[model samples]
Target chain A: MEERKAIVEIKNVNKIFGENHVVHDLDLTIYKGEFLTMLGPSGCGKTTILRMIGGFEEPTGGQILVEGERVEDKEPFERNVNTVFQSYALFPHMNIWNNVAYGLKMKKVKKEEISRQVAEMLQLVRLNGFEKRYPSQLSGGQKQRVAIARALINRPKVLLLDEPLGALDLKLRKEMQLELKNLQKKLGITFVYVTHDQEEALTMSDRIAVMNQGYLDQLDTPERVYEKPATKFVADFIGESNIFEATISHMTGDTASIGLEVGNALCLLEKGVSYSLSEMVYACVRPEKVLFSAGEAEGFNIKGVVKEQIYVGNIIKSNIIIANGQMVILSRLDIDEVPKVGEAVNIYWNPDDVVLMKSRGYQIHHVIENASLGGD
Target chain B: MKRSYRARNKTIPLLTTVSPVAIWLILLVAAPLLYVLFLSFLSTDGYNVVFLFTLDNYKNLFNPTYLEIYANSFLIAFFTTAICILVGYPFAYHMARAGKRKKTVMMVMLMVPFWTNSLIRLNGWKTLLGKTGFVNTFLQNLGIIREPVEILYTRGAVLLGMVYILIPYMILPLFASIDKLDHSFLEASNDLGANKVKTFLHVTLPLTFAGIFSGSIMIFIPSLGYFFVSDIMGGGKSQLIGNLIETQFKAGNNWPFGASLSMMLIFLILIMVTVYKKSGGDMEDLGVM
Candidate 1:
């Protein structure tokens, strides 16, 4: 794959608010015309990164480059990036037309050109008739469209959106998600979006940068990030997966044998990555990858009892307790009859379907604590 | 029957909550205003008011001397309000953006002067601006001036006194409105490629305009009627309509004319308020209710 030149580069960015270190030594590259999302939980520094890129915030200890030029000293207005704020910060006093035309007017653009561009941008956001409505008079979705129109009217090289659809209802958010992705594709402008919604990130972004505690856990295409997470945090954060601690028992060419208490299974160590015998590792397998059978099965299979079964529209979700008493979830299409609770079943998975990652030392402890606390 | 039930429910709540304030307003405010209006329509003889109804007092209000005093009062109030805005705006903006602890400290400092009587404070200013007092003495000793310059008892002194007394009124409402500004709008402006000045002009100033209007009214209206500051600081040469009305009631013994002047001030205030209401200023911003 040919790597495109980056439109925005964040290098060793750190932000400290009072005594709290919010963003730490974060580095990222947003390629031109790419829809990149920074996904994380709240307070995980995703919004801070977006703000730094939009020049709303200054990195305490590093440089940010836009179009290969350092913009650390530039004010927000001096930068070529615009932001769609989460609150949809449309000026309360101005109508939609003036709000969208504000950037062009600030640049002293000609009156005819300003109105033409404003109208075009409003139409692009599907807000053509809302030109005369104040922000307070518009619905949340309409306000969001106006904010997007206002930001895009400047024709900035990169648009930074900080959870722009977070205020909408779920159905509207889903619709706007597709609309925004389609808009980005049509405009061919780089989008640096911040969102805590992993599903939204996966649905819209060309690439995802998953963040945890101010560090980039993984950055890759959505399919790759989902199928082969670089770290345990990314695997646990991006989707539903059954993660367990396993000990490496043997190593072979491009593969390794990890021991489970009830049985042993063959798992592939990451290519060009080192693993040692008797080392602890985190093994993740998506619920859909775990196949369930009513009887004993051959090849890396474990005998377990179905503890609970839930029918969710098109899929059946069942919690199975293996022989060693470790619990793992199994999901399968509901085309087959529902598995009876307390019925004995065998769970099987192919070795290649599992992902092996080095332990994120404290994450296991945190998850364990959370699980224990969840019990009444 | 249902409509009548609903009306009864609403009326009971309204009566319970609103009647006390309405009665108090009628007794203390409306009664005095009506008495003044009636007095303004009556004729006065020497120190006594006659029962006969007349418009002579209202006609006398157009006298050139009274007109000049009204003009002086307007000019003084205008400058006081303008200066208050010029000084208070930046101060309020700074306070609004300060850190929590710093904002609290500044607010307390702004309120410290209010603990003492404003009259006493104006007297303190008189001492400072007096010929033998702090400012002139210090200037004389520094050889900047050979003699103590006349600093007190001037038009400038009256304005200084008025602004000093009314600035707190200007600052509080301005602070409330400026501080209430959604900071995200400023960020949005910056993101739209507006520099700080442009952001302030296009975003901050327009949004905080209600504060400016309310604060201006707060200072301007009171400055028009506050006679003590001029009496203490202006040496009588800067007598405003307030002083003229005061003299008419006291030394001049012309109660009808004095009542007429009070009514005129009220009329001006009403006009100003009407203009404010028409200009999109929120009545809630006035903090009157």
Candidate 2:
């Protein structure tokens, strides 16, 4: 394995706007040539953290080091990064050619060199013939491409993107996500992308930093963040999961019998982590791990009546109302048999599938909001 | 006659919608201008305006004395526009970026003076800059000067008066334009490796050029005809086109000659307006409303 080099390091960063603490004591180190995404809901300080790195924002308290030099006191232009703003922010008064050429022109580059590099960048963004048109004359996607070209022409060490595809329609957004990912790989440049879209972060990031409530919840590969979230917020923020708030009724070696409102369930305890009797904990289980059966299954501890079933693309999602009237979702492959609503069903999962985590004192409303936002 | 019928149909709607403004313009604006044009080509017979066509009044415009007045008028207009831009751009720029509360207070500060009659305001300047005025008295009491500075009733005084009255016109449009500029553009420019000065030059100035053009047109044209300003401030020492035309009508008793001078001023303004439109200036950018 090659040694991972840290390109930008943020240590104990804090940002406050008026009285609201947008980011609190955030510590993140971005490696060179890796696509890192700060993923969270809006107002979760993801963009603030990215802005602090790009020098657009001054951290209230912290030191940000870019390539081993402190950059908090530097202006954005003096930093070694460029940003592709969400609005595109192409110079409205210049043609596409001049817009792409602006960075080199500002640096007083030679005319021929600027032209060559601008032409190459435009070609790279696949906007080859849009040189003469103003930004007003281009479509949303073309304007987006022009913005990327303009930023990339400077050849900075890192690129900061603040939801660059957020304004595009769904189809264009998907296409651009792939294009931007490929462009980053081809250029071998580090990208610090900020987005509230969890699916986008999952699809595009080499590592995802799940953030909420001004805290860095977890940073890991998308698979790990989705499967083994460090905090309850990361579990809920990622793809849909049913979280069980339960009290530890009994404990054994590497297993615990937790008493949930619905019923008692056997769950896995993290190795070396201790849990006493009646300690409150959150148990997260992916929907697909919970099975819905017409008849009582073996080792079935949770039972509920079928509330509703939805067909989502290739998967069938069933909501099972437990004995406590709490709806626990069960996602499965569409096997042509959805238990009728109001019918009884047995819901169960393997004990190891439940990942027990500490409760962060979040209420049920926050989980529901994140689930609905994920649906969007 | 189908085309004629179509035209009539269009006219019926236009008549209902636009006729009031059209009639107002033609009757009040065009009629007087046409009368002036008629008088400019006519002869005055012993205080009686005659309907005889003559170019004598217009040819008199080429006289060296009148030409010197035109040159002086140009110089005053140029200086007034230049000074207003130099002073107003920074104020407008700051106001545009200021917080809403501060911006509101500053906006009130800028507009409160103009709410009063401009003539009265210029008269206030007269008292302020007079020989025994507050400024002179302050300086004399401070012992900074043994004699009062001759600031009042000079060309500089009239120029100052013009700028004071017209700076709001400059600042309003420039403020609107600068405020309309997306703040993200500055961030983008800085992100693209341009410093503040470069960003301002390449982005801010180019985007707000329409405001400058509209403001210049507003200040330059009015400074030429603000006859009362020069009268009160310049002490009638140097002749301006406004004073010349005023003398022709009041003391010289040559309405035809005065009409000719007004027509020439109108011609100069027309050229200016055409240039403004060509450069993409709009009435909305002028912030007149």
True contacts kept of 2: 0.95
Q: How many collisions per candidate? A: 0, 0
Candidate-wise lDDT, in order: 0.88, 0.89
TM-score of chain A of 2: 0.93
Report the lDDT tens digits of candidate 2 across residue range B1-289: 9999999999899888998998999999999999999989999986878889999998999988787888999999999999999999999999999999999999999999989998888888878889999899999999999999999989899899889988998999899899999999999998887888989999999999998988898889888888888998888886778888899889888999999999998998889888988877776786563
lDDT of 2 by residue, A1-376 (tens): 8999999999999999999999989889999999999999998999889888888889999899999999999999888899999899999899999999999998999999999999999999988888999999999999999998998898889999999999999999999999999999999999999999999999999999988989999999999999898988888889998998987788878778888887777888988777667777899999888866776655446888888988899898889899888888888787756677888987777888998996653344356546755433
Backbone clashes in candidate 2 total 0
Candidate 1 lDDT over residue span A115-216, tens digit each:
889889888888888888888899999999988889988889999999999989999999999999999999999999999999999999999999998889
On the 0 to 100 scale, the lDDT of residue A205 in model 2 is 98
Docking class of 2: medium
